[model samples]
Target: MGLGLFRMFNCFSSKPREIPIILGSETPPRPKQRQRKEELGGGGESKIGGILGRPYVDINTMYEMKKELGRGQSGVTYLCIERSTGREYACKTIARGKLVRKEEIEDVRREIMILQHLSGQPNIVEFRGAYEDRQNVHVVMELCSGGELFDRIIDKGTYSEREAARLMRQIVTVVHVCHFMGVIHRDLKPENFLLASKGSLAPLKATDFGVSVFIEQESQSHMNPIHRRRRQTEANKACQHTVQQNQRRPRRKALTDINELYRLERELGRGQFGVTYLCTEKATGRQYACKSIARRKVTRKNEMDDVKREIMILQHLTGQPNIVEFKGAYEDRQHVHLVMELCRGGELFDRIIARGSYSEREAASICRQIVNVVHVCHFMGVMHRDLKPENFLLVSRDHNAPLKATDFGLSVFIEEDKVYKEIVGSAYYVAPEVLKRNYGKEIDVWSAGVILYILLSGVPPFWGETEKQIFDAILEGKLDLESAPWPSISAAAKDLIRKMLAYEPKKRITASAALEHPWMKEGGEASDKPIDNAVLSRMKQFRAMNKMKKLALKVIAQNLSEEEIKGLKQMFNNMDTDRSGTITFEELKSGLSRLGSKLSETEIRQLMDAADVDKNGTIDYYEFITATMHRHKLEKEENLYKAFQYFDKDSSGYITRDELRHALTEYQMGDEATIDEVIDDVDTDKDGKINYEEFVAMMRKGTLDNEGVIGKERTR
Candidate 1:
């Protein structure tokens, strides 16, 4: 439905249990005699051997159950520690005995299929492996320790239109990729989106597509609701049929995953990456592209690691067509052989230039194809840091041929809260932030804007006799909308360009937002109407104010005295039924009733909706503090001091370094050294401990510098 421009690799994908090394070829296994069908998933009294590629082992031998991660109507997810490796994974235990309906079984199968297919995708939370017990099915997956996305947005001082655009772009791109894979995510609300980890600009991930479809069974018009409904019914029926049809399984020897069946045909291309050769499978005589990279040619360890990572990324994206399909990989003493789908047609620009005098409609059409590939890449958490036209290839010489993105040599998987400072990308398309040594995926959007501008006008947006002048113009961001043909360009098109070219990285429109612009919707056609001037003015004002308000909230939240937040946390814990450290609405109701106050379900929902800043369905300490601070009744300063005395343990009205250290670390405030530093800064008498008067003075921080209270000031 939209076009995508990249900000970076967009390659940050997820976990796997036994990630098969794609290289080092193995001989094809001899065919084994097929066994007679038995029962569901080879079921005969549920004697487990193996179903998927993984071997069945004692589940208890592998993982040590830590604590509950989450609970739903059908299952409970535990934070498990792998006994031998000490690696953490999420293990979902779904009680089979609790399920009665055939639909429920089908649901389990559906979830398994979705996780299996989308396992290694970046934006989607990963599926490691699954095991079956006597009474339940246990599915293991990557445990995302990062908090939810909307929660960060609420608490970040650096929030802006650009920030919102970046996050939404991730969401939309993920949805876009899911659609391409024939999986329609039925539930995509804020609750389903999480940051891969904490801090700012973490990789946003999609999870819990509970009502999602793995594959569509019928074609229908997306614009028509009736046809869509009919398609839905067909898809559901197909899913049920698939589950019933696979009820019985036949045993057979597992074949080796190898590309030894293929024979080299001819050399296609050669570059710094590797030598590409045309190859064909001997059994089926199907064509393929094989990349042979000599190990000796790679001088650095990191470069060789990059080569290995590329193969892994390719294997993970095996079935997606937008990405070049990975067939297999093999390793010899001298080189690595990576096989893939061959694109006969050349670069996208090669066709665009050859066609000549193309209309705006054609430009939009071509741009849409590029967007689709980029959308998938971003959703997979891969940033194609380099996104010029040369990186994309047409499937064939045909005019209507689709394009696929390639050359992931520059791609890298980003983690949640990580910011890349590398200077990468072609000179013309690089974003301003990149030059400053601080940037994110937004670099791709800037590059895409350059592409779109050139596609529309057949000339570069900013140009000069030398590279320096060109870069200067880019940094200045002055576009000549009135220059020659631009005067005749559609206002919607011009408006989009202006938004994209905004000087401030914090204000630039995201690729997703750009796709939704009227110019994009019109397919490059001129719009008689422009965005309402007053509305536009109001939008500008709102964007500015929204940025400030979010930043202010973040500062206030961060600067809040730990004592104040601690009080709210106690109240939060009282309502936390499972002692999970977060309180859901049901728990809140029960907890509040126990405390002699009863609230209706509607009222409870309303409060949770307001207080659950992260939209993670539960309220943590931060959210609890944020919510309770605005309550009508306030805790007296004397009460806060008394609470401090309680932590003192000796009723001495003072806290030793060890006592304060234990308190702060337990509350997730800071480390031991940080707690010591904070106490020393507020000790007032050069003592090794913090007294009540000094603590109270530190809490009332309006009179002192930041060092007096928290040792350092928080800033965006």
Candidate 2:
């Protein structure tokens, strides 16, 4: 009844076709598939229909297969012409050998059933029956030769908002029909929808029911009581929602601008999608971290969905221990501001590095907290797709501050029996199954295991010079348990790590089980002995190496020409809001906040201290320029050479201890230990001095050692 369903679905024509003249006439018995093949001089029948439970039907007799259309994980789609009607159609031939598991076979059967059930619906691909033969199952359906929706969109370069709305209406109609028919189309992406024809107004047809399932009451009853209620609630909410895509320029409810409620402060951190800020509530004066995602940045459908999902996840997981508290979400015209708990203690590794060295017991305690987060997340029916040290923050500056999982950008609700195919998360922490493109909630455990490995050994078990190399190492699975720190690590801790890092996702330890492990449990077997000092030294090599690089960047910033520092002058002026020609601590903080930083007060103070070269407690124009210059400027060979020359003041081609001391002292980081550590880390030849090549290498190394080489998120 919606959108004149009979007109929208061309296959549902009211005009009846003339009855076949031969319908009541005597008919010959259908020949067996094998006999037909023999009479046709074809090969013997193969036993591909063992699971289909029906005799094989020779599809070639009815349709002539032509050129291959495309291929999927387990099947190849081909263009075909029906012999009787001489009409074109698509034939998806799935090989029996590819459906190795019983579940896989069942998936094929379920998809056929779903297509059949949805055949007559608007925006759904028409079903032409499934035929199983000797080698494969052939599903013939309507041929959408207009190609994928994504391809068409790409060809069009950009679509008007009206066009996007029209397309979305078709998609939403499909979803609406699916839910009404008691079906769940789990894998809905741009590629899964195809245009019916090449015309501009061609209807879109949904395909790829490989991961779809029927919403059966029996299945809902099988879920755990807690999960059952949550799933039911979510399902009901999804079905009740209606898409108002056709309402052009619809009125929007007034939203409170985040600035009206909260006084935005200094920047905390910046990410791919948006910038985070330190915000204080006006009435209560209570500070919180606000992640303001620009609406423009989230232009894609998936990106907008991710932002909404993250907000929903944060709200759902709020009040859980070890999870960051969600204060509220405020959406304005420009941005969606998510106000969350202000974690002042900073990143997990930052705290650990500050402690210098920690005992095995301490490592166990930290690991326990991380695993507990996993436990809580899984129990709440959430899968935190991205889990790493940076995503974890301490709630306070206390020595034993509780760790809170702060980011849920890539997280999703745990869909029971669904195998996640999206490759996501940080490269170093990604699970083996994730790389294989089939994984579940167990990936969280693998990531936690990687963190524990770093906690114990001071380096990732999968070490490499590049992201690809790191992925190769992860796949290679060569864990170095006999190495330096590992040799000294307690047996019980190693045992726990082994279980958690098991190559098989099924074999890998569950978060609940890991929490119960002797090494992780309270009053457990973790020893109090301090981990090897080499481990701490290794940690510093990666964690604190950025200090020397920062000083070099400061030098480079000084030498930049007017053109090179073009916008910086204006930026500094903006930051010096008071027109004092110098930016005070508060002004700097507020300016960074406006620019979308969520840096804590202490971190902001540290930045101010670093940039205030003369220790005047404020940043002048030039000082602000130095601190704000981006690292990408160092990509220029000339800029690097000039920075190197600044440190090698004597023109000796080598930065000796005296020269290093001078530069570090100028930057207020001239401690003897720091100087030695810098040389030890950067001087590749074990020489006491840094050469031109060595300096370039040190400056080129990624700030977080092996981190960020794969960017903020690695997705496939």
Taking the tens digit of each residue's C-alpha lDDT, what string does model 1 give over 1-716?
Answer: 00011111122111111111112211111112234321211112213222211112245655788889889998898999766458788888888776666556545655655665554444888665566555677777778888677677777756779878888888997787576555777667898887888755578878776567644444543433223333334434333422233232211111222344467878776543357789987645778888877666554344454565565456443434456766655555566777778988876755664453455556666665565555444444445676666567787888788777766655554333445665555555667776555666556667777777766665557664223455566777777778656766677667877776676766776655666666665445634432223322222221122221222232344446666465655676677869887886668768756755444433343355445543445667656665566321222464445446645877777788787666554443444434544654567697888787776555443221111100000000
Highest lDDT against the true fold, candidate:
2
**Model 2 misplacement above 4 A:** 1-239, 242-253, 544-643, 646-680, 683-705, 709-716
Q: Model 1, poorest ten-residue lDDT window?
A: 707-716
> Which stretches in model 1 have alpha-carbon errors above 4 Å?
1-259, 464-469, 522-716
Expressed as tens digits, the lDDT of each residue in 1-716 for candidate 2 is 11111121121112111111100000111212232211111223322244343335577866899999998888899999977568899999999888886556656755765675565467989776576676898888899989999899999897899999999999998998787656778778899999999998899999888766557544443443223223332222221111231122222212446676688999776544567899997746889998887776565444555665676567555655688977666668788788879999987876776677899899989999899888767765567878888789999999889999988877875543455765567767988777676788888999999999989988888876444566778888888899787878889999998998999987888888898889898889999988887887676675556567767876787788888787888878887888989988678778767876665443354355546554444677766666566546644789999999988998999999888888887766545666767777788898788999998887776654333322122111
Give the CA lDDT, 0 to 100, for residue 139 in model 1: 79
